[model samples]
Target: MSEKTVIDLSRLRKPDYNGSVQELYFLEEHPEWMVCKTMPGGSVFDVGTIFSIPNSDICRTALRHKIYSLLETPEEWENIYGHICRKYARDKEFLAFLSEGPLEDFRLRGADTHHLGMIDRDTGEVYRKSFPPHPSQYVLVKKYKIIKPSRVSYNDNHLWDYSEYYGADKFVVPLENIVRIGLTSGSSIYRNYLNMNDAERKNYLKELGLREELVPWTLFAKPVVDFTTKYEPEDRSLKLQEALHVSGSSGKKLLDIIKMCILGAILVSEFFRKIGLFLWDLKWEIARDGDKLVFVDTIDTDSIRVTTKANYNNKDYFVNFNKQSMRDYYKIMHSQWFEATKSAKAAALKSGKSFLEHLRAGQAEGYYPGTPQVDRRFIDIQEDKFNTLIAYIYGQATLDSTIEKYNEIGLKEIGYYDANGVLEEYDKLNGMGEETVVRSQ
Candidate 1:
């Protein structure tokens, strides 16, 4: 057993950053530590999973730490977490968040209970009997305090948004994001390339004017956007800081971060594979650590998407263990509002406006549909499924006793409603291995 360390965050400072999904703060005692708390906006909007999100978050975070700790050399570990933080160590609080059983059991079982004396940020009292009904929504990870250099800025460039292109915007660089996609059908790149022949695919790449180095990866099962290049034709080179519209700092570059992400993906994918699930894709949030880029935020079921191997050959291939269900619920139950949002977003993009802007305008004009409240029955079903998924993943419950039943319900709903039309379109696109390469374990 490892030695225990105290985690006194009672002197926690106000959040340094207020992100869309989570807030970032540091403790007075452990100044190097970063404390993350999930917020209501972004992904948590529909289902109201503020309290429960941390349960999944801490589990995956600990799992990542476990995988990375297996590295033999200090250099190997440094390549990933060195410049950002020396290590990833879990105290009593981390374990407490994940403990479904009594906290006393963990102490009795020889687990380090040092951080058990941790004071709650809100109440400023140590947990005595057990954790609250739902443990505190916090992601506690040790990280180096990034001292900003006089010449460089870590603001804009550091927040790398690896997402799909809803429109041409300051944040949404379609070409760059397309290159970062994985094999999952949820990616627009995957769906777009699903039906194209090699020649047509080649033409498509040429039409988009993608860099030659990136062309090879566009069709790969996992495309890591590591190639160094200029985003524009006339530019000599694309400096990381300049590309992100920031200044410069001092060890590794963008490619280094991309390599780390790939390594993380492999580690996560292998772990899930062992548990009879395939890790599909991930939404990475990396920040500049002085001179290095390190992954921040959580890596739970919320950030990563996974599917069962049983659906590998079926139309429901990319059906995942995430908020896709909530999305499907909207598509089926509130089709008008869903269609209206899509149309309004498209129009907004055409006029060089954002979806948010369109939403505001549409509401004022009585044209945009308001997001209807989700039925209480649907929300209950989803919460039950989420709990069962966590329980199933952690070995607290058997598969058939939990997620399997929910999976059946989910499949039936999605299939019957033809939610998102992914299944039918996939079938029409010629099923598995027809036009594109369907790589699987």
Candidate 2:
């Protein structure tokens, strides 16, 4: 919402015989003068000048007089030009002329490249008109069916628009809701863990049940040890010095090991609930925006790896073994999860039963619990179904089996910390390490 200035209408007059009534009226309504002229081959130039001038009395008087003359004079198209020019003079910066004539002429000439007409759902024909921008960009439009509406694709239709048109409520869930929980913490856990000082490194190893001497014997142990010693004092220069001491190969090896542990922590925290039916191995990107480490990428199925319950078990309970496969699998799994939830809801409503009851029935009938219902809205079921879904996806579920299952699927690391000294790590067992190198290069 920026301020706009009006152009004087009288300055637009050229040595034409008369003026146009329609043009005069347009200037009166839209004091912001726009240039509209025909081109050589029936083309039109409809351009708006980007200039502003103070709305003054002289310009107002000229506008009124020019408009009056255009109306009074019969076939007086010349008067319209006078009014338009006067309007244009009010705004000095209104310089550039966008040609509407070309667009209009292009349409009139039956240009095959012009697919500008909008289809009217009611008439099933093209509707030629101007469309304005909406306050919200998320609005979508869709058609209703006689019996059941067909599934809509996000790419093909606007979810918000369709929801509004169909009387379905649309809510703007903030992008923050999809953010990883650990990212809310200020420190980059992966980077901090990787850059741990000797004491911190020993502490970490102790957590993993490794003795002091045993730590150095592990693969990539030197870098981990160095990281511990470097970051222990929070001394920036010292940490860099220590990091520089390690060879690139050692850094890569240590980074891989750290990433695995961090991925384990994330998987343990977020994607545990969907463990049994679907594997969740997702690419995670984090950045230090201000003092916080924020996840900045799509956590959808496309960025993650997912597998069917059968396939996962058949493959010995593995998820994304590589970054590409991991992301691809997650995309499919996420889509499937969404579809399953929709189907389950539809089934429950159709049967006039609660989702949990329907799920219980399905379980009895030997159907896999595709998105289990944790609670009933009608009654205060202990487990909130929606909350359960959120918890499961974010790896906040209480079930140990769920946690173990996702871990078995192999979480791969994919991103690093930002410039604010936030530590980053990625899962390396699944070739995520290789994918990261390829993408970075």
- Could you give the C-alpha RMSD of every candidate to the true structure, in order shown? 12.2, 29.8
lDDT of 2 at 158: 18
Identify the candidate with maximal TM-score.
Answer: 1
Question: Over 4 Å off in model 2, which ranges?
Answer: 1-269, 275-281, 308-441
lDDT of 2 by residue, 1-441 (tens): 023222332444652211211111123343322222211110001101111112111222222222222222323323323432454454443211211222222223321111112222223232222211111001011111111112333543311112221222121111111112211011123335566787887775564333432210012111111222111111122242333232122343333323322322233222333244232223333222222222222232223333322122123212322123322222233345434434554565455444456544665676533432211221121112223333443345666644453443332112111121221211122222222212211
The 10-residue segment with the lowest total lDDT in model 2: 38-47
- Writing each residue's lDDT as its tens digit, candidate 1 over 103-177 gives 222223322111222224455444332332233445455454332212222532222222221221212121121
What lDDT does the true structure give each of the candidates?
Answer: 0.43, 0.27
Best by lDDT: 1
